[model samples]
Target: MKTKNIIFIYILLLSFSFAQSALKIATVSYIKGSCYIENSIQDKSITPLAGNSIMNNDIIHSKEDSFCDIIFDDDATKIHIDENTRVKILSDNYSRVFEVYYGSVFVSNAKTHIKTYIQTLNNNIYVNNNNIWVNSYRDFDKVVSINYNANIYNYISNSQIILKPLTAYNIFSNGSVKIDNNLDLVPDYIEDESYLQVRKENRNKYDVYLNDYDLIPVYGRETEKRSFDDNGFKLGLTAGTRYMNNNEYLTFGLFPQYKHNNFIVYSKLNVYYDYFLKCSSFDDCEFTESGIYSNWESKNDILEKFHLRYHRSDYNNSFSIYAGEIPQVTFGHGYLVNKFSNYYEYPLRSDFGVNIDWKIDNDFLNFKFLVPSIREYFRDGGIFGMHASLFLSHRFPLTLGLGFVMDFNQFSQSPRVYDVDSSIDSRQIKAFELDFELDIIRSMNLDVSIYGELVGIWYPENIFYFRSDGLMPFSDDLRWRRGTWGVMAPGVSLLIDNKHEINFAFNFNSAAFYPSYFNTNYLYNRSLYYLTAQPFDFNTLGFNLVGNQIGMLNDFAINSTNMEFFVPKELYPILTNKINVFPLRGFSIDYKYNFRNKIEYYNAISVYTQNVGQEKIKSQTYYTFDAKLSIKENILRNLSSLNFYVSNVFFLERDDREEYTFGFNMMFDLPSDVYILFDIGQVFYDVSLNGKRNNVLNSGLQLRLNF
Candidate 1:
């Protein structure tokens, strides 16, 4: 009887402890669409029904086009979960906390005695007021106080901030913060009628109590409601006149856009007419001299921009597709292609393009595909490629990727000039790359990744080599046929607080291959080989001289009338480095460096020998710098923004002249939904390789109206 009594008392105490540990902290009062609860202990998820119990450490997830309301055990405290939101509940003796992993949540704490805390990826928000909203995203976190005040603590910078009523605060991952005083710019979902109704019904049913506080103004609510009601169809018209070099032209454009949910359709139609080409009568006009009239000669002009875009993102999956005019495209670490664009020559030419991107489970698998010129693809050959990356593990992820790109017909751009020989066939160019990356450190403010890539470029045709044949150079037999390969090893990437990024890599290439072969300038440089190709002159081959090539030529002239020139074969032990900085909201800077080596031969002998030339290695370093500044927020009265950019390039030994470009653009807001825009640009280059340089200046002024 004594043992039985003791066992009974022990079991009774255990049961009571279990009951305390499993106490319900909240309940799902209302749900619209699919809502799920994830059991923290079992690691399983189940559809949450009405009045579902939410215990400590339980996670709630709301799917797309869904929302839910949760009534806490306090009865006076409640929360509304928006679509695509994940929240975890934590309870303690002192307070109840909601950990928002991503998405947005609205909290209404009517009781002043109860303490409510909202934790995010980078911030800990303590709600001291009656109504507030919190949002956490991959790149930033945001907080808005509707009726009262809140205190926020940043985990990255270890600082605290106070959020006042009718204010919004945005905290970026880089430890930068932006504050807005206007509540009208808040997300539209927060003001949805359905969500507000659900919150009201839940409060009434639960018999929640509220303390008197300052209420929002009637005019503010009316303004927000009117803004949403007026967001239907928008059309913009722009009329401008431009002066280039000594000629003037008229420009007119129409921009129409429509967006609903995750789908959007946008179109731009532009017309340019030369001032000198206009005549009193249509019959007197010369269509050949008019830019607008001549545009109809090509089919590409008709499809300038009819862009269609669709994007959808769920808790663990996202997909986006775009058709028409892809401004920039890159694959992998950009070993073979980087920043390739089809809109390089916007007004002068255009290309229809397509792009698709898909990501699953926080980059566990990422895939991308692109077509540079869809019209050219059907008419001739075009550029196409795909890239895919797979992450093996969630913790300590080791990522591997494969990339492939092909130019079906390299000569398709100018077929007539390249079809010189029948025997030299196969104008295809293809590249293959295999890459791997490992993250050494990933934290809230800093990330470091180490990566490497191996790439190969193939050309089916034989290599054309110039060889000396007596007095003149001649094309050698088409015997040497091989592919070029390159390697980028020991690369380091550093991202600091999402504001600054730095990259450094060591590149090695064989005889004929180069890194970033298909880059921003690929469109214009693709057909350059045809003009520069020449037969090798055997008589000009010579050994190294003690002085410069010009001095050596003088010596050669003193000895003999014939002169020899040094020819170099490019080889690599290349070093590349790039840095991008975003120090402020509307300002950025980018710079890159390429250090390369070239092998040269100097004349040391009177006659040509098999291997008697003095070999020399020279350094050719290339540098490019770009900077931009744009002010969108109103800093001055009636001045919308003043934007400008400057870019400069130093080719070192590659070119004799340096290149520079400058552009400026400004916008001013006028009365009655009207705006005035002014822009100017200048480009300096030596197109003919002569000593004289050419400067191209362009300026434009326009008036825009939005309706």
Candidate 2:
């Protein structure tokens, strides 16, 4: 019995020794998109783990499922996991190390803090784990981080290992073992000096990253960039009150857009009523709505929330070149055409137009036209062009600062003419202009332009018995119309620069509309000349304080005309043109001073005439004031204001008695990104007579929520 007991005691000690583990243990199960297999079991390196496996510092296991043939992408490069392999992410989200048990895998060594366990022996390699870890010995002259608490391990290197140059032996074992804080018997270090301090202060700085590549949903800036891989879309709204006939009414608007690549399909609709809590554009926007995703990316729209009240288009589907219908009216970067808010009166001001822009060789060609076939059906069709125009614009390097614009307009098709002078059958106007862009000095650009025009008339009423190509013969039954009559006008202008130029204009009037060189703002007779300004990026403050004001001035001086009424002529030129100085281009500077109502002095130059016809012998000027300014535009807006004015006039007869304006009024705007709009408008009197003034006000308001 004593002998048996002794045998059992010895067996017990042997069992205890065999059971002791070198590290902690755990297990994991397989999920989707992976497979596992068990193959070899030699030196514990070839053993396969399946269904729920775990380890710590010693024995290792595969990821998730026991079987392991996995694929991962990142610092180690695209790695292919062999059948039945075991590896470990030894470091937690707070650690910077990974551990590989044993297996054959392809690894592409990369230079990044985001690293992998399969160390690089060369630029590239595929290994079976025989022995391939760089010689990370002692790191004598290096300042490396050793986060024992975080990594659960440390580095150890002796003089012998350091001297080995490029070699490492089995680490941490019994018998000939000598340990001094060395992990995997390997020395780890970093090239940075303050690494240790950084690791100590920040715990999760090294958190292992897992993204969509891992089969789970993730969100971030990078994720956002990927979401809109194709074209983007925005379902927004546009609502605002339009002042007409001196009355105020409520307005509601909606705008939705779908964009793919550069192709766009957008539509807008607006409804109106009257008087609420101060009226503006869009009574209710889906800004704060729930469920929908509102991103800074949505605002990524190159253009901002515009007053889109109708369907408008500018691009055309065409080959490199095509002889399109209505070959005239070429375009160069202008969006939208209704310059004034009072479009109800100018019903035919819209146009069903198409534009083509293509560049080949060293020349860039662009052309556009309005289709006469589509008429009143298109709420946005302009009738002015029913007459005619043939425009051709070209850019050349043949001569320095030398370019030309040729345009031809004729009353080729007279379907209907409500107003006509029986003197001519059909009239045609043609002009050709040349410009030399010269840089006299840095930043001082000068475009010297010279052009001549030819106006030919066809007579439908004449005294002859037969009609000549230039004349229509008169019969007792049919009155004769004149044919083929003509005139020529030439002009020149000096532009300091292409961008917001300091301009000077000198034109000799001859025909109604001759060439574009004489167009005060390049705002009309687009038949030639093109002016384009880059839009401001959200991040670009744009000349700091001149953004909103820039748009307003351009709207009037270059693209849209302004109105100034109520201030008398004695104070007109001084209060207006003096302040506006010469709005040859869309640019303005303002100055203000006032001391109570008794001594009120207001001066403003709002570009009022888009065009003054050469034939309009009766020249005139009437005072008018109506504008909207807001801070929501990102800068330069304060004390929302709405004021009315009545003034004298100096016209064809230099009469001071023929002008007046009474309109609706209200004002307001918000901080950044929020809209606050105001309107003060009305048309009191006209017709080369006396002056008058009328004023009215209406407003409304509604909070918005984004979608």
Candidate 3:
């Protein structure tokens, strides 16, 4: 009897050894379209078939419109690969492991007790006897728990979070995590006919257990799950009317878009027809050459947008390029160019622009480039800028950035003569900036950083020639220097919960230097002159001089006798502060303040700030406050979305008037994917003389249909 028992034990040991030797990680159970397997060892690619064995480090890739299913050796564990997905099986240990580089996948371990791990760039998810959906992208990872709980481990923060059923977690590239609850965990693609057929066949052939909820057809949920696919063509039409500057225009536009994977082509064509109306009284016939009317007079009235964009990203790197009508561009703290838009005169004037951004090794290095207006480049000259940042170390979280911007011709859009006999040469203005940021504290809920920027601007010599002696022209050294420098140092930035942000900085500059020279109002302020010690004599062949006073040219002047009349303007140091708060989704408040010494300029070209009441100089403050609310999904029926914004600007020292702008936009959803958009706004412009302002009333309504 002892010998018989020994023989049975030996047989059992031998069987266990055989099972371990022939262990298979997983098997490809179903393939819908264009699915392939890549062998990591051999570097070979193969079109996979049903029953194909999946091994460690085998990469599974599904092309566009293609998907596949894999079943583990345990039979109860499975994964559904979505279109345009790439995943790798990393290990065949007791706890299965897979890494998702990009795209989406559905993991099913509902009927098995074995633990499964899904890893992404930012976080790792562990599941056991639970089904979950995971979508990984270059900058973020999204996870949804279907029926059971899962645990997400953030490697960066060293935190573990429990993901309950019907909950979604979004992990950003910066290691910040956001959680949302009460969501539908099932993806819409699972209900596709091909996927359904494959699941049905697999259930019968392999006798896999699928829940009733997974097999049942879902209806009326299509709208909630609607999303753009990899390939599509869509066209939208717009019909609107606008009233500005006592003139009315009927606007019509066509927007066409085509997308294929990471490449997209978009174009917009707009036409504005002048609408004539008979005036009943002389007071009703006020005419002004401002706003849209000026855009028409400039003859830039046809194409609004035409661009090709290509974007692609993975866990380690990303690249994107846009060639056409870039809406906005900013570089490095916006010291030189901030919120500069190529479409400043949209609907009437259009610009061709190019923007490129590239990131390597997950923010180890980043590069950005922008050409403000390619169309104007060859004709008149344009602005070109590039910025780069390098992450020094992860432990310290310090970043160093360099930026350069060149306006090939600062006088491109200015009047040719500028009341001078000889036209000014194409003045090339260049700016260089070096910035550094060090994070004092970085956490999931709060972030604090201190940054500084040292900037220098170079202006071309001979901005304007003045008569030093009879017929001998020389540049004014005292008035216009060749170069100037500024510093924005010891800036503090605070962020809370990824929703509220506050920034405070101290800016000091030389008299000739200007911060944020190329800003949102650059187009309007480009031609304005700077203020000089004395008012320019129109009889002499000299250019106008202006100073930077927010959006308007400095009108203050100092009078002096003799050629020694030029006095260097004492630059006032500024304190800049900004705050942005988002109390809820789609609602935000933004406030910005620029505080400086209140300087009074005398007719003798002297500058001084009053210090009568207190030892400190009096303060001149310019502030802008804006509040916006956008609601897309609300309890109100027929109201698809509503966007309302109110903005006010106070330049009390310069204009002594408050500029208020407010707009209300609403969209109503109709049948057949059609929508109606209505908008009305009151915009203020610095059109009147003597630092006065005028308000324009503009309203528009449009119909859009998208497919």
Judge candidate 2 at residue 399 and give its lDDT.
19
- RMSD in order of candidates: 16.5, 27.2, 16.7
Task: Name model 2 segments beyond 4 Å from true.
Answer: 1-231, 238-242, 274-364, 371-373, 377-500, 511-673, 679-706
Which prediction has the highest TM-score against the true structure? 1
lDDT of 3 by residue, 305-385 (tens): 577889875434779998877756777776676667665434333566788999986538999998866655555778789
Q: Candidate 2 at residue 44, lDDT?
A: 39
lDDT of each: 0.58, 0.27, 0.58
TM-score of each: 0.56, 0.31, 0.55
lDDT of 2 at 684: 26
- Give the per-residue lDDT digits (tens) of candidate 2, residues 253-330: 565666654355554334445454433466753322122111112321112222221221211112221111222232
| Model 1 weakest 10-residue run by lDDT | 575-584
